[model samples]
Target chain A: MARRGSYAKGVAKREEILDAALEVIAREGFRKTSVREIATAANLSQTGLLHHFASKNELFTEILRRRDEVDAVNASTDPEARFIDTFPMIIRHNSKVPGLVQLYVSLATEAPDPEHPAHKFFTERFEGFREELVAEIQEGQRSGEFNTRLNPELAANSLLALADGLQTQWLLTPTLDMAAHIEAAIESWRSDPKP
Target chain B: MARRGSYAKGVAKREEILDAALEVIAREGFRKTSVREIATAANLSQTGLLHHFASKNELFTEILRRRDEVDAVNASTDPEARFIDTFPMIIRHNSKVPGLVQLYVSLATEAPDPEHPAHKFFTERFEGFREELVAEIQEGQRSGEFNTRLNPELAANSLLALADGLQTQWLLTPTLDMAAHIEAAIESWRSDPKP
Candidate 1:
């Protein structure tokens, strides 16, 4: 019973540290933020933080993993929900968490190099996300929810790009009202004929 | 006569160094690629490279500036061309230069911070680009080339986002057909009713 209690405490501490790290990274960006600063923010000694996360890279990777997990959960809530239908909601949720979005954009841009630590993660993320989106679009077309004239693969890529691009613009210009723009794009996708 | 020849040689050397720096940055990212590597790749001594570029940041800024200049020239060829009409061609051109595209994406992601060296450049670039796009859209509407019902600002922002997002995805997956996807999005914008 004592072991279980301690394990639960450890999990709580880890979550606290991740929260602090997210704030620091969001405020200071990944390149400028340091592990020591994250440690201090979490009210833990650097050694204590190290105990939970072996290195800054490990901590950063964990944060990304957790974000992906959350996104996966949100995306899967309705097994019957088409992925395209949920994108605007996801973008709306993302607007509420600017720091996570910043981290994603910054790291994703940096991770294109084959040697970057997050390279494989981002590559696989895009490939998997693209595939899932393509399948969803195909399903929508079959069900007549989406225009059959549009190429599913191309439409899927455009939707993903629009979401990412809007997040970036919103980050740069916070007053941009990202959700509305995304909704507009989605609306167009649903109604427009092939060009 | 000797001084004139030396000045011409210097100009040639500067272009050569920029080319090498672009190659190095494209191969490794901005963070990992060093001034020393750039100097070596340019076949110049570190001192020689410094004589042209005071630091890596300066060199990077210059590279970005040059790319922008090229983009501006390409985007402005037909004075009467609607800005949105040229996007597909620009994207087609971008596909031929993955290195520059990668550099732009990586740096633009990092430049969101007010303190980042490229922060002003990116902010101004987006603002200026967005304004130009808005103007172009307005012109298109007046000329009946674009849907008059669309908000020029929203439509312009969406188009820019689509371009940036497509570039990021293209960098991640070189096989993606970026120009075609962008064209489709633009087509939708021109025909779809507001949702």
Candidate 2:
């Protein structure tokens, strides 16, 4: 079996590569970005980089997987809290990471093609995202924390769309106050009267 | 100078080419799509197609311009009416044209890159779209049709985001009732309490 030290080193190296890949993708876009460039940025030879990810597709998949994990961690700060309550904080946190957001928007658009490698990943991501938001809305309605008259499914879908759409627009115009817009949208859904 | 008959024929031919290009783009994404394929679909030689649009960039720009013209026409059914008031109708009309929607979503995502051919087109499109919506929201507030408390710019941004975000989601799940979701979201912004 490999020693623990080497395994830890491997994990660190992998993360370093992902960070470099994200930087390149953010600057050059996925179509123009090359694996060699990522390897160079990571301070590894092409062979060494390939050792961690056998192909470009593998590398991109891992990047997306890592992103989802990070998002899950961000969403889990309070397990018992409604997910929608945490969205503004999450969106605010996201604005600081433009490269990651660009990578996501870029991949999500391309992945709509059923043949794309990231197709299934994006499909499941949206499904799970919508399902979780819908559940949260329903739970809030049941507890009278939300407007019961609102259709949970429609609200859930709109919320998801607003989040995603704002992200796309924000990428184009960094000056946009993304979190504030999202907060305003969510605030509109509150059952309580605004003071 | 060209004769009137030949000029009309040329215009008809250009439209035919654009229609075929849209079909090809919808079937195969922009990345996988080729000019040769478009020519084949349009029943023209590649050289003949080039005579109409000197480059792929020129063709794409023309297609986007035409789409904007069509959208403007759709929104102008009642010139005196507010633009936001017609968004649901426009979005519903969009639902009938999935190919156009796919082309738009695909191009908009790619256009975030400053170097992308469609970058300027999308930038201007978003800017104009937001400006128009903001103006409409302000007008509505003035007329007491919408909540005066709503920030016109924020509401306009959110509305644009909702439209784009829903389109992306609808592309993923065609069963989604996109128009209803949009209408519901708009209803939430009404100043007058729902009876």
Backbone clash pairs for candidate 1 read none
Write one digit per residue (lDDT tens) for candidate 2, span B1-195.
267689888888888788677666555545535668778878888888989986876677667677777676877677776666777888997887776777777777767778777888878888998899888778778878888878989988888888898888887778888899888877876786656
* Model 2 native-contact share: 0.70
Which RMSD does model 1 reach against the true structure? 4.7
lDDT of 1: 0.76
- Candidate 1, residue B154: the lDDT equals 84
In model 2, the Cα lDDT at residue A86 comes to 80
Candidate 2 residue lDDT tens string, A1-195: 267699888888888888777666556555545678778877888888999876776677678777667776876777787678788887887887787777777666667677666777877877887898888878878877788878878887888888889988987888998999988877776676755
lDDT of each: 0.76, 0.78
Q: Specify the CAPRI tier of model 1.
A: medium
Give me the displacement of residue A183 in model 1, in angstroms: 1.1
Query: What range of 10 consecutive residues in model 1 chain A has the weakest lDDT sum?
Result: A185-194
Q: Could you tell me the TM-score of candidate 2?
A: 0.84
